[model samples]
Target: MSQHRKIYLASKSPRRRELLRQVGIDFEVLLLRDAPPRGPEVTEIVLPGELPEAYVARVTQEKAQAAWDAVLARRLFTLPVLAADTTVVIAQEILGKPANRDEAISMLSKLAGNTHQVLTSIAIKYQHQLLQCTQKSEVTFAPLSDSQIAAYCDSAEPYDKAGGYGIQGMAARFISHINGSYSGIMGLPLYETTDLLARLDPH
Candidate 1:
């Protein structure tokens, strides 16, 4: 198999792009039809009784599969596809991206003064082989006030990010500490991602 110098990233997140760049990985953004229930996009809706780890891994695999399908359907040059998903969980409940400012505030309210799990799953699809891994990080928040949550929600960071917050943004003030891959909590785990790429590429 020919080694790929660049992979196709199956996500629209700028944070993911930035993370990939930080580790000196070359990747092209592969856009997928993400139109909710109307498009062929992968649905993130958690299945009944699905564990948090399983949910993240499933979504990442689906995204990687979707990207591979797009390449074949569109006749694009074949390259390894990399996809990732991140979600915040507190009290065993998975918290996805907030739909509105009120929801964002509410998500943060529940997260304040508590330690939560940040689950990020990564998948790489090359040829008929698929490799995947899930990174779990623990993040603790330094008790936030209603005003702080309101002010943070007023910005544009929370709407597109998981758990209604971005660890690399102003939300850093809200996080007292993190006990795992920082990039993982940010949406992509650099160490795990680099390892997968090395395995995919044949030097």
Candidate 2:
């Protein structure tokens, strides 16, 4: 069998690294110091009342393109670069990383005893070719008391996670059920990500 293609991951998320390792893909971290400032694209389609799926896909694509540009500018490794973005949605509202403890608690309160969708979009870019995919998972949470929310917020786990919870961390107890890819909910969808890489490698 041929060797798998060397790859690069353009992210700082530990969860993404763990997921990629779980699939046995040989890769290196692609860190870009001058990467374009990350943010939502300002477009007519991203205005208020826009669909979450479309918005997230656009964001991921933008991130991938930005990383690709950075790689070219810096003369980094010439390999497939992967980038992704994950967001949590509840009743049409997108819940991104919490800015502060109070915001995290508020997000958790809204998610309590309710089902929300987690959307993760991944992009792979090599040379001039690009491929993108998205995975959505529905997660239901148990009713959380104020104390539970406060404790979790104080633990430093929710501060960096979307939806104010880390499914694989201390917040696992709060999840009652999940209706889709667990890995996707964690930040990176393993199957989809690996499949995309396979297409690029074809070995």
Candidate 3:
């Protein structure tokens, strides 16, 4: 695909927008919402006994499909729709976005002094083709004090991010290191995403 080709981003995540801009990919934000009866549902609920990898991939595909449905329903301009999902996993337990301050603190506490996997799945849909890929990054967090966790949680940055933290935000100080794509941990993997788009228009 041409790097300049405009696509639709089916997410409101600023991180994703920033990453796309960094790579010089032009895209428009395509927000998803239920359209009453028969509308596409984009719930984050994990299926029973779903593994972390499978969970992220499934959600990303669903999000891309829903975005396409919305575009068709609204008769919007036809463009390739991109969607992604991210999740943090530790000891095989998937930690989604925290619901409250306490949950954020709990998640941070568990993450302190430990290594966790950040799984990100990116999907794109155009015409009759759907392409997808999953990226995994291992993040190691330094030992954090109770005071530190509380202060970070109080910043209100953990509420909307997976694993109760954003690697590009204040939580950067907590991450000792990462073994995979940094952008993936931030919610989008630039390398994988670009590659997938390239596949969509292989010249």
lDDT of 2 by residue, 1-203 (tens): 03445678887789999988897777788764533476332221355766889888887787778778878888886778888888899999999889899999999999999999999999998777798999999999999999999999998899888888999999899999999999999999998988887677432
By TM-score, how accurate is candidate 2? 0.90
- Two-way lDDT contest, 2 vs 3, winner: 3
Winner by TM-score between candidate 3 and candidate 1:
1
Alpha-carbon deviation at 18 in model 3, angstroms? 0.6
> Once superposed on the true structure, which residue ranges of model 1 sit more than 4 Å away at CA?
36-38, 201-203
What C-alpha RMSD separates each model from the true structure?
Answer: 1.9, 3.2, 2.0
Give residue 166's error in model 3 in angstroms: 0.6
Q: After superposition, how far is residue 88 of candidate 3 from its true place, in Å?
A: 0.5
Candidate 1, backbone clash total: 0
- 1 against 2, candidate with superior lDDT: 1
Per-candidate TM equals 0.95, 0.90, 0.95
Please report how far candidate 3 places residue 148 from its true position, in Å.
0.6
Q: Candidate 3 residues 56-120, lDDT tens each?
A: 99999999999999899999988999999999999999999999999999999999999999999
Model 3 CA lDDT for position 32? 86
lDDT of 1 by residue, 80-187 (tens): 999999989999999999999999999999999999999999999987878899999999999988999999999998999889999999999888888999999999
